[model samples]
Target chain A: MTDISQSAAVPGTAPQRPAATLSARLARWLPRLVMAPSFLVVLIGVYLFIAWTLWISLSSSAMLPRYDFVGLEQYVRLWNTPRWHTAVINLFLFTGLFLAVTIALGLLMAILLDQNIRAEGVLRTVYLYPMALSFIVTGTAWKWVLNPELGVEKVVQSWGWDTFAFDWITRPETAIYCVVIAAVWQSTGFAMAIFLAGLRGIDSSIIKAAQIEGASLPRIYASIIVPLLRPAFLSVIVLLSYISIKSFDLVLALTNAGPGGSTEMPSTFMFAYTFQRNQMGVGAASAIMMLMTVAAIIIPYLYSELREDTHGH
Target chain B: MATLDINRVRKAYGNLEVLKEVNISVGDGEFLVLLGPSGCGKSTLLNIIAGLEDITGGEVLIGNRVVNDLPPKDRDIAMVFQSYALYPTMTVRQNIEFGMKIRGIPAEERAKATNAAAEMLQMTGLLDRKPSQLSGGQRQRVAMGRAIVRHPDLFLFDEPLSNLDAKLRVDMRTEIKRLHQRLGTTIVYVTHDQIEAMTLATKVAVMKGGVVQHFGPPQEVYDRPANTYVARFVGSPAMNIIPGWLLASDGVPTVAFDTPQGEAVVRGVPLSAETAHRFAGRDVLVGIRPEHFGLDPSGTVPVGVDVVEPTGPDTLIVFAAGGTEVVARLEPFDAQVGRQERFSVKAEKVVLFDPATETRLD
Candidate 1:
């Protein structure tokens, strides 16, 4: 109360009043100002690099940077390349398989854990621990396990089952599915954790009301529980799709875009052109295309979810 | 068409007993209310009858069929919980039709039942709206409609009006009573509100410490309580219990005590020899309802009024008499604060209980 009086008196007549207001303004703005330098530095670097890539793409840049300009010639060359088309087709194959498997596996795991089973804590830790590991580690572990000669095939031969052949990692047609399996194993745990929290947030009284009405458990879950979990499912789908589109390290570590580039995703293609082949122009174009694709898919879904949340309440 | 009987029901949690040997039999088409204060095990007893809770040692018979082993679904009882428990995802129509739909009722009949219930509850226009979209009183009506639509063997209400505001609670209480009257269904209702118990209950069972202290018609339980607990619990402004001494002198029984101004006498019959042996010439408690005390300044009972609470209908005067703080409900125009007023109580209206046992002497 005394402080209120003193502050009112001080603000009423003082030369330092303007300075005090100034200090308050500076206090609010200082963090953004301090954080601007690092971000601004990255922004400038990216601008120069992108301009340089655009300039080189117009020219016949080979293995190193060139400054000659030839409009749309390199774009025409990129369109004609069969490997570029293969990479685009393979991108969809890898992402589609990864998304489907991860969502299915996550929902199944979430439902199992929702049951009143014993040792739930232990089971949850086991399932969610995979999310903490890097996809590089997961992919490498699966790659070795699925390798024909060194791992599965050799082990099966030692067990006297020489006819058993496990060679998906060595074949171009079947290798995309192998990468999908590893990616699902890595991301399903994360999606399950998101869904598990949503399941727990549902009111227990609603479930009891269903039971008291003589509804069988499955019918109640199918008709009531699933519909209530729609918002949660939307969030899970959006998060997993983002992860699937940007899947680079897992594909690189598992198949290395090898066995004839069967598992080549967009991010992996961007990295290969930028670092391996020094085709940074094509790589930067692919990066911008990937960003646009994600925005186009995610923004509408997020906007609808937000509108429903606000208006429904 | 069903008469529910609870036979010697006892409930315990490990070492702590929650309800003790509770026996109540509700007749066909009777509205039996389990009335008590909070934590008095009234809700627990209701839960047992609804088959929502397992009775520790007892049998519950619904229409002569022992149903203690049945689940809540199999018991043919519908309970409207205190929280309403309306599924937030379901519309008002679906919530009412849920039980019928689950029982394989035809859609045409379900719609007919739902429309009839909605019309009866005056909730016709709000059928498609979810529970979250409805007001508190509307949601409460939906919960009741869910129970009424079932036409179950018995209706169980667990303090269903406790969550509503004061005015809405009163209105809904009357509505539920009217619904019961029209349907003539046997219902077991639970509430801590003595006013609701007195107004709506065909029979009242007053419980305390998990034991049924008294069970009878509401007026009978209020006017003639079986023990000190029931007498004090069944009335608003609570009964005034004063410490006194029992006297059985010269073949006549009476209670004698001293007030701040003078000594007083109360007329009553002492309990049996085995009951009187423990309380003869010993300190006892005399219970008198607040309304029983009236102004008769020259009638011998003298007390100084300490506080006066005027609530339109009656005035509650807190006074000291017989070495105990007593509250008397007096005519609003006659009572005043901070004055020595003489009050007279009828001898026939007083209830005497032995202090050692708390059981009514006469």
Candidate 2:
């Protein structure tokens, strides 16, 4: 009886133990299996395309990507183009103005709304509602408003002011300024929301202490409160600066490189050359330059931020 | 230094009155502590004095001038906040000199004031450090240094020691008292801590629901609280109030209390004859500090101890008196659980209050 029981137990236990181990292994791997599909998609869709684009920029690809061995010729050709020069200069101006104006307006609005004011919730929503619309929508709406005979000028003229010529969208020289106005309108609310959060995080006692120390309201903001908002300022500048560099849709929807390529940007030039002009080599080169510009701005910032986090600040 | 006066200050938010016709005045170099629990409007009264919050219905005068219409800056005061409120981005020197710089003091004078303040606070070595690098106590000192450098007529401290750990709080408390003694600035401080109020204030205004229940020197407030609320709120393990009916059968008043003795009538309860006559047959609240009770073999009431709390210095014996849980500060082993123990109140230490108004009758 003992022999039979031992033999039966050994056979029964053998399969059960391995089966339990196998199921446990499968359970451990299930989460990774579920995550694999999305991970693989992003890996190929983003990183793989980036690799492909880098190779194409180096190769001699004009009409349809002729991947011949060429060394920096496309880059050399890209730098010599006057339109590219105009796009690069426009990038500096647009980025500087966009960042400065957005931060200033956003900070001002945030401070105003923080005064324990009545109807604050309603006002915050009104200011931030523009952020919900796409940049294309902002650009299109601004285009009509900035049009000479059809928009704000026409409306004002009908109101009997004949000399009001608010027509920057029709002129190359001032077309970028129209884009700047629309861009600032769309993103200032986003910056304001961030600044407001930072402002709220400050201790109320600081302001009271400042007030009792004989500092006026303006001096408090200028000397104390604004200096304390350094992190918020950093975040706003980085976000707006890169957005300025990669501006495409706003310019396209509003002016479309209007009135002789006045508001042309790197993104616009890249699109125009790659698809319209069939200069794929130069287009890829310009795209690479844009990426480098963004990297030059962002890499150092991210490094410093990460370094501080690791240092346990 | 200044004589700070708050004349019938009334604060209301629409229909909800937070502070109702409060009044207190202090001479130069006096420390007045507004003591209460949270939402008792102590902080509100402090803010109204600091000109941080509007006085809905009163005038605040500092050094004889009514500062009713003046902004906080023009009021010539300094404030130390609970969080320290040191400018995080500035060094200790810059923080101390912020007010001076705002008043457009020359660079040399600003530097001299910063150095002098830093030296006075014994933080000369830490003058170049940012607030973030300092310990909690050091930050507290820096905050004090900032207030000190301003050299204003008055200083307002809003529960300044509350944010520190227990040990640090005690240390900082001593330091603050010393600072007050040396500087002699008239200070209006707000805190919810009874011990801090008792230890620091020359005058304490014990508040409840936005009104001052008792305003006097700390010892007077502790020994003779103006009302039952003041009696209960202003002590560590507050004064126990025994509720019972006053018996004045033969022109002498006695409060009859319940105990394991079934019921005991204690006579010679101290009160004026008019108060004794007025509440002859009604319920009266008897306020007894825990230390005023003692155990004796032939005491009036026999109490069964429910719990023992030995707090290192003395043991707290909790028992039922007049159908209320009352604690008696006792020598250890005087009372034990599940055993009947005889206790009696010191006749002279007993205080009487009318139950109807919760006010002291005499």
Candidate 3:
């Protein structure tokens, strides 16, 4: 690549090496050459888009890009909007309940499955099947199941008890709770699998020793097994937080910020204002807010995990 | 201390019988070592005593109470596992105090017991450190410390030193022996290492194929094994078993087998009256310990040496005898490979077994 200008300018300053030497020199860049495509893609696709959104949030953009700087005006407007306020509140409500309920249900299932049960393989596969479904599918399925007329309420009424009402999907105040239920159902199995692996990796002799030491089953798990599962718990929490922060598809498919924006989340708000509502600046600001939330939860966890990996446990 | 009685304890997993009619009982303060190779049901027998496995057709009595239906926790025992089994999340102090705490002992008492155990194990500095931070030998001490603080009636050790290095294993073995000496608690230790069994057990039960072949003091088991299997299992450089002919010479019994040199006769074996009468004209298997062979230059049992293994204390002379390889422990300076060595087998120590049944010909 440096063939023409360097040799012409230097005349005889540049020594011409043998073909073997040339190939050896080219071998030095072989690894970097092979790694370039993926590196370039990530640099453009992830960071470039991130930088573009950051700039858009700082500018006076409506449907398209504008050069005039607006400085945090879009953020102030987002804060003042009632629907955006509902979205942020719902995000916390969903994230908190989703995490708590999922971890609890997942741990219960993992402990049950760890009991050397018959048909454990089939039961594990059934429990884990929901994690294989996309959020779109889970959201759509739960929407129907929670429907007052077509699903659970109608079925319960048909079996008598005609006053049955399971319509959390339709109420403005309770709509966010329905989203939490569906999200937890879709993610609990993921947590369960990780927890189960952690449980299996423990030396079973520890349990035997505890039993011989006159510790009951519950006491053993409380004092020893569960505490040893800290790494699994941390990983599951971080992954669920990431999922909750970027959770646009599930909300869009199930509630669509529905019941007059009572169930709207930050992800849904960012999507609506960015693509459909012609307010790019507000959308970009909401997106940045969501990014900061994810980074807040994830960066320290990643730092601890990486640092532990380097230092070794 | 408690007496552990396994009365006809039979363990089976859905028709594959792991243990069959295993009957053994240890007196209070007896250190019983269950010695056997793998898959011999030695571990199953130990587990049966610990109430870890269900007894299919027998009763296990701990201090005269039938504990067949009792869970391991109610059996009033502490087990040191092969893997150390220390709760990885707990510190040394917590690990030691776990049993006492679970038993609802007062916090002060639990702390006192934990401190006592840590001091006893010389692990006072390691009380706050987790098991993962400890070395293997330290982990073993922590496991034993956990057992010690329990003050359980019986202590069960399931090959607790198998994971250590050779040098460490020896050190830990001595430490376990010393611990046993200090406490004198009734301990049932399981190991495949014959040396460990011989050195530690007041009563060693040599098991093979789910049957106790021999049960006695370590020296008695080594000197007078009940069967060919016991004879082969207990001694280091296992007892050399040679198939031979039995004949009586002036009331003292003698066994004759073919060596590379010719037919060699080992006499002066004192056989019981029944054995002498029954095996007078039958084939007898001679059991001779490797260490019992004396390096006599004018010895009658001549054999061609193949290899010399000097193990610091004694040289093991490997020789081709009859149709099988036999090893004799001789002085390091007296043994050399590729040369014939005449060694005298101690006749009184030469026990005989009936080849048809492999039972001792007493």
Q: How much is the lDDT of residue B38 in candidate 1?
A: 88
Report the first chain's TM-score for all candidates: 0.84, 0.91, 0.92
Clashing pairs in 1: none
Best by lDDT: 3
Candidate 1 contains a number of clashing pairs equal to 0
Q: What would the per-residue lDDT of candidate 3 be over residues B52-98, giving only the tens digit for each residue?
A: 88889989999999999999988888899999999988888888888
Error of 2 at A269 (Å): 1.2
Task: Give one digit per residue, the lDDT tens place, for model 2 in B225-342.
Answer: 8999899988879899998878867766688877755775667777888888888888888888999878877877677889889987888988887878999998776456878888
Worst 10 residues of 1 chain B by lDDT: B267-276
Task: Please give the ranking of all candidate structures by TM-score, highest first, separated by commas.
Answer: 3, 2, 1
Identify the runs in model 2 with alpha carbons over 4 angstroms from their true place: A1-31, B245-254, B265-267, B277-282
Top candidate on DockQ is 3
Q: Regarding lDDT, does 2 or 3 come out ahead?
A: 3
Clashes in model 2: which pairs? Answer: none
Better of 1 and 2 by DockQ: 2
Q: lDDT (0-100) at residue A295 of candidate 2?
A: 94
Output the worst ten-in-a-row residue range by lDDT, candidate 3 chain B.
Answer: B332-341
